[model samples]
Target: MGRELLNFKMFLSVLFAFTVGYAIITYGRLVREEIGRYDRALSERVQVIERVKAKPITVKGLYLTASSAASSRTRQRIIELIKETELNSVIIDIKDYTGNILYDSDLDLVNQLDTERVVMREVKEIINEFHNADIYVVARQTVFQDPALAQAQPEWAITTEGGGLWRDYKGLSWVDPTKPEVWQYNFAVAREASKLGFDEINFDYVRFPSDGNIRTAVYANLEGSKAETMRKFFKTLDESLQRSRVYTSLDLFGMVLESGDFDLNIGQTLAVALDTVDYICPMTYPSHYPTGHLGLANPADHPYIVVSNGLKKSQTAFAKAERTQLRPWVQAFNLGAVYDGPKIRAQITAIEEADRTSGWMLWNASNNYDSRGLLPDEHAAALRSDVTT
Candidate 1:
């Protein structure tokens, strides 16, 4: 009887062991299958993200300040304008002249420096809204004229002769252009902008300080002439951004187009800029031109002549460039003269008449766009058809 009982116990123990082992094996298989399913789902998600492509359009755009971009009413108005008119693009300020990033940034330095103001908290959503409307979005980033960066990294700033931070005419501090760190910072911003779904990155204030106490400002690391330094910077920017999906553009002074290799001491020349960027956006505001420009007493009064002549000169200057196209920033504000529909249309006509221009962007600091000068959607479509034909 004792032997029989002991045998029964051993049998029971064996059965329990087998049951436990089978359960473990089954759970392992289930876990592996679940993991495989998750991997496939993740891959599909990545593919979907990668499939989103920017719509190609001849960008007739308007500039929006960060504040205006963030405001719902302003944004709606701008969208309505685009839907009603020939405009197909919007340029929002990612980084403005004040050197504050308009949205939250993931960069360690940007965070550490506390430079971001979070003006546009829903930047991605904003971009998506524009995309939904079939509008191309461009991020305008002001380089070098970064007061925030200069304050945070004073060692990298353009210093005054007395060793204080040099201030521009507007009392804005700037980072030294020659510093590699400055280049890397701006590159990182551009990369972030591209990742955020901006179709283009428009870099402004790329040159050395154009206005300020010139004699007192000292650049510690400047090696070559200002023009050469600017050229090198442009080449570096091109190399850094070449593989990026977003297009690149530079905001050049209008005079650069007619300067004939003279850099205006701001390190901007048309030829080099044309070769470096996908688009060269000359600020061709007739109001900004001095008296006697284009043989006119007031260039602002003759918008057609100023724009046509400037663009004509630019076309000649960059006629050989294969990649870059002209997309100028024309005046939309009343600075020197009242710019009504006729004046605005004059500028648009000038751009359309150019031999190689891709488009034009209107600049009004107030973010108030006058749609009278713009063609209706149907008219614009017909115009596009004619051009294509």
Candidate 2:
């Protein structure tokens, strides 16, 4: 009987030892996983804190194409112009019409695009140069008209009835607005631009392809109307950028001011846009206006009247909103009428007459600006006198 008891004691000792060993192994793994999760959460918190906000300012700016900024001579000339005139800001293309990124971004998502294209070797240096001259810098990114992105990720492109990627009249492809990836990609670029110290991030081509075949096109993932999609995009982008300091602006069709909530069938309208973004930029280039616009024989022929009326219509539409500011894109190129110095000034004058003070941007595709209209009369006189001397 004593021997039997001894054998039973040995069995209990072995069982207890095995149970203790199993518990130690399982508990250790759980503790390690908990530590890893804690580290990841802390890292994310740090990333959120790192993004700084852009300084707010009233911008009277000029658009700069990627090549214009890449050239040393062009950049110097732009700097001189900014110093000489009442100009305080420049909107440089970070992602242009071709959807090519102009600068290298460290973000993983941008890495794929950057590998295919990079326009500037010294973006930060140029921005610092502009800042030193007291010029505010804005990063202009084209949102939906991204041919490169469409080509790279075909699933993200707009689909046709034939189950193929739809191409606009210009043969340029566009991403569907419904894709969350599309929104995320554009916002990621803006986030990186904000990190580069852009005072504001301006989005252009935020609309759908107005040139594509309308009836056969299919928005595979869109759950609502075009205007609603764009409004959601604007709101989502705005909310996403809340952690950053850079201001948000959207470029809209000049006629959006006159169209009410119709959205031009491209998903952007003045009313919904006003409630979402920080600044509303209507491409108020006189040449872009249609004949009989505002009851004029040719709206382009009357720059002051066209611009002033557009802003007034916009003001009447959103008189209650205080969040979004109105800044119009004026003509610097001679597309319809003679956009001389006086003609350019007409648009600025119109902005003032309309009692909108958000300031304006000059859009000259070639970057050749005649400063006659921008300078005050006294300044122009002094400039002429100095030249003679």
Candidate 3:
């Protein structure tokens, strides 16, 4: 009887051991499968995030009508030109060359001041029209060089050595870029523009006034170098526009591309500026580059080689370092008084030759695009026809 009992106890112990071992193996397998599923889910999420960021549609076109002779009557013709030229994008001058607010700024300060001189009476209507026409509208805010704002708020103006407002060659006074107050003001306008449903905000004159005597001008009481100030302003702008859900682009001087480093006087560093904005539009207009750049006697005369080489060098620099985006501004205006179809096409070809997949915006200050009837035969066929959408 004792021997039988012992045998039963041994058998029961063995069964219990086997059951625990099986449970351990099952649990291990379940954990492994769960980990595998998690990894796949994480990878899919990452892919979705990347796709959200990297779907490439062409963000190209022309800086249009506000800076042009195109009147409201010519709106249909202008839209027609956009279709005809194969250009789907238009940078409308919400604020223009003169310090006039093109639209009624809803900001309390602006409205209270009655600053809506020369307002575009039908801006929202026009934008809606353009949207229906399948055109993307970018609000071009001329930063820093705002005489209207400066004249109204002289305290914000950059002062000269003699304690007076400094004027550039164009007799324009600029707000001090160093002042956070100035940044707040400009950013307020940007926020308002964003609320108005602009697809993007293109900051022009986003730099210190370099046309004046940098040596004699006195900046506001601000710490850090000029480049740092510029970077900070960009950062501030970026922060301001972050909530807008729109792409932000900065208009930089063409020289910033070729210059070995950021022009401190103008407060622009390619690398630093690129960090803050979605697109860095180095106005790589051949007319802006000095004579004898890349062995070209006249940069304006040789638009293709000048812009191509300049952009190539810039791209190489960007690649060597860590530049995320570069959208160079090619010349659309006549520098040497030679505004023709060939000049326009040459600029486009040079941009294409540089191997950048994105498109370019032709900037004619007059807003009159004579090239509308003329595009390279190759591009003419690809122009989208359904503007009513």
Predicted model with the maximum lDDT? 1
TM-score of candidate 2 versus the correct structure, residues matched by position: 0.83
RMSD of each: 3.9, 7.2, 13.1
lDDT of 2 by residue, 98-129 (tens): 88888877878667544236777789888888
lDDT, candidate 1, 1-389, per-residue tens: 99999999999999999999999999999999999999999999988887244655689999999999998898889998898798999999999988889998998889988888899999999999988988899999999999988998999899998999999878999999889989999999898888888999999999998889978889877887788888899999999987678889999998888898898988889766767888999999998899988678999999999988888887777778988889999899998999999999999999999987889999998988968788888866787789999
Q: How accurate is candidate 3 locally (lDDT)?
A: 0.73
Scored by CA lDDT, what does every candidate get?
0.89, 0.84, 0.73
RMSD of 2: 7.2
The TM-score between candidate 3 and the true structure equals 0.78
| TM-score list, all predictions | 0.90, 0.83, 0.78
Q: Which stretches of candidate 1 lie over 4 Å from their true place?
A: 1-32, 379-389
Better of 1 and 3 by lDDT: 1
Number of clashes recorded per candidate: 0, 3, 1
lDDT of 3 by residue, 110-208 (tens): 676555665566566777788787777788888778787777777888888788888888888877887777788778888887766677888898888
